[model samples]
Target: MTMELCYNPAAGERGLGDLYLPEHPEHAPVALTIHGGGWSAQDKSSFCGVSQFIASLGWAVFNINYRLTTIAPWPACGDDCLMAAKFLLDGEVPEFAGLDRCKLLICGGSAGGHLALMTGLRLPPNRVAGIISISGIDELTSDFALHSFRYEPFFGGEPTEEKQTEANPLQYLRPDSPPVLLTHWDNDQVVPVESARRFRDRGRALGCRVDYYEYSTEDEGHGIWIPDSKPHRLYPHLETELTRFIESVRPENPPCPTK
Candidate 1:
């Protein structure tokens, strides 16, 4: 495996990411991995382990860092995600030369998830195979999304119907939207699981393929939805489910000649 830091000059220094490429990259897919930190707290390093794990599965992973709310506001973070996708889709990044652009997937948890959804929703039809959201906020008007102190600044003052609907991924669902997989912890103290369910229902109603996975920690004493948490017994299962969803949505490619 090889890793390299790439910066998007247009986005400034904060718009940087670590690209991980597999040794044998022929016909490999790529995934844009975002980190969760309420849109202002974490950087690309937060998803290093997750990116590495995905890279190990024959994927070229771009773990990105976007300008936090402290630097900008609403649309800034999501715009950065779209910019990063454009950077890869431009075919100028050498480390991702072997990636199958048509098979790209966007994934993240929490704030990253919201960004992923925004990016995927705005992307050209069929550009991305799928999107994965873990504990993501689908409805910006939800109680948690409204009361969470971490969101006030990101949304730029008090939440309004217009702004809330604009950021709500559920409002963007379309029949042509890329397939999406959402995983949320049933016992989550943060974002409610109902958001995921409602989003999934809305997507399905729109004739889109939507997969929803909910996990509980009653037996384990705590929610184990996020990967890399202590007692990672559920990590493998979560990853497997994500991998399967991604592969299922990907378009099969013809055999590539040996290097």
Candidate 2:
């Protein structure tokens, strides 16, 4: 689709953008991809494999990025997401023209995983068909929050237990939100598996479809659950599982007639 960078006057930052569309496309569904770095680091370029893999599957994909804590924090990432979603849904780029008025699948891992859930929650209901969160956080203000005290200064003062609930992804849940796929390793040193568990519990409470899995071994490390050298089956297993979960969702959400 589109790969460009422009200075965002509103945010006063240069954001990286990448979009991949199906060949011979007039219109096609899309998935928004986010990368994780504890909100302090990471970029969209690192997602080339995931984006290309998705494009090969006949769906459009976007590897979106935003300013980091070193650049801008909290709402900066959120703002970047809002802008990207608006841009794609309006078909501002030719490659994404088909995704206008269409549904999307949002996904990410680790810090990226947190971003995926938060970004989707900030959008309209079912605006995202599904979410793939890999070892993500449920609450931004928790003691076990990935960033520890790092994000607190950004959030302003100490994050209390009461606020923890509100800061949590579960607090944002509604019955109408889309389905989700949650994955994690039994032992992730960076992001704890409990984070995924908490988020899944919230989604289930809301009656959303949640497909969660845990790798029995730790060969894949924190952000990568499927090792490339081990076997060909890992990638296919993920691709197949996610595709099946997302394909079942229908885009019945009321579309903006004029957009």
Candidate 3:
């Protein structure tokens, strides 16, 4: 079942989310799925298919919408994501009362992926089980020139060196960071593949568990998990790998067990 509710009622529509509940949802792990549109476009509807897929795996999925850069820039989008995650973890909404708060996982694509990394890393330690970033930017300053059009709007203009560092997900890496799954197509033109490689290497160097997958083919490009003609279809092995990662990161002493 799917229910649409406002996580932050003050923000109205932008704070709304579509929560997909699993068949036996009591104590089921929850996954927060964010949509990718360079942080300025798209909505939770863009992630409906992926959310349903996660729900099929027995995870209650909450696909959310955040204020676009057009309406608010810089930290606005990131704040919304963090608020959404907190809403779920705190059991603020009765519909999600019995879900497993300790095992919440965050997943997103492209710009959404960047937000996922930022949100998961910034949240209280051990609050997030894992993070999945697909074709997400790692360092904001490195590729600013190439993506100035998108980055400028999101950052409210050319970002200063300090602002860039603050926005870069790589800067938040630590030994206790939640395990991450990063996937990128080598031929990606939007967010270069090198960013993922760098993040994985840095995370591993810091003793953080980071599982990465690189699609060598050109066909997959940016959104490998979301096919154009087949929106519901996920790239081969994507589901298996995601399932494996989620299982590996399950909290040792969960708040409760599945009903």
Candidate 4:
């Protein structure tokens, strides 16, 4: 079953999400999926199919729409995602009862991917089971000029070095950070693949588990969605990877080593 509910009353419709429940939702794991649109466009609807697919895996999926950068700015979109995750974790909603709060997994693509990392990393240690970032912007400081158009508005115009560092996910890497599954195409024209590589290497050096999949194909670019055929399809493989990662991070499994 699917239900639309508001996560943040203050934000109203922008904070609403579609919750997809599994057949036997009792004690089922929960997954929060965020949509990508350079942090400016798109909404929770963009992840409708993806949420349903995750739900089919016997997981409750909450696909959320956050405040766009055009309307708010840096931290607004990230804050909305964090609030949505907290809503599920708090277990106040009747539909979320019996769901596994300790096994919450967050996933997103492009800008949403960046927000996912930011939201999950900012939470208390071990709160997030895992994070899946697809073509996410890892380091905002490295190539600011190339994406100034997007970053400027996201940071509320002319981002200073401090703001870039503050927004960079790589800066949040800690030994206790939730395990991350990062995937990106080598030749992504939007967000450079180097950012992903840097994040993976830095995270690994900090003893954080970062599983990275780098696609070197020419067909796929910045926005690569799982099971989508338009740009390039990584259907079964992506699905399988997601399943395996979620399984590894379940509450029954030991917490990933921080050191």
RMSD of each: 3.5, 3.8, 2.4, 3.5
TM-score, per-candidate, Cα-based: 0.89, 0.82, 0.93, 0.91
In the range 124-205, model 3's lDDT, one tens digit per residue, is: 7578889998778865654575766676788898777788888999999989898899988888888988788889889999
Query: Where is the poorest 10-residue window by lDDT in model 2?
Result: 225-234
Q: Candidate 1, after superposition: displacement of residue 169 in Å? A: 0.9
* Cα-based lDDT for every prediction: 0.76, 0.65, 0.83, 0.81
RMSD (Cα, Å) of candidate 1?
Answer: 3.5
What is residue 56's positional error in candidate 1, in angstroms? 1.7
- Residue 85 shift from truth in candidate 2, angstroms: 1.4
Over 4 Å off, model 4: 143-145, 226-234, 253-259
Better of 2 and 4 by TM-score: 4
Candidate 1 per-residue lDDT, tens place, 68-170, comes to 9998888888888988887766556567665776656888877888888998888876677789987787666564554567667987787667777888888
The candidate, 1 or 4, that scores higher on TM-score is 4
Candidate closer to the true structure by TM-score (higher is better), 3 or 4:
3
- Which residue pairs collide in model 1, if any? none
Candidate 1 vs candidate 4, lDDT winner: 4
Which one wins by lDDT: 1 or 3?
A: 3
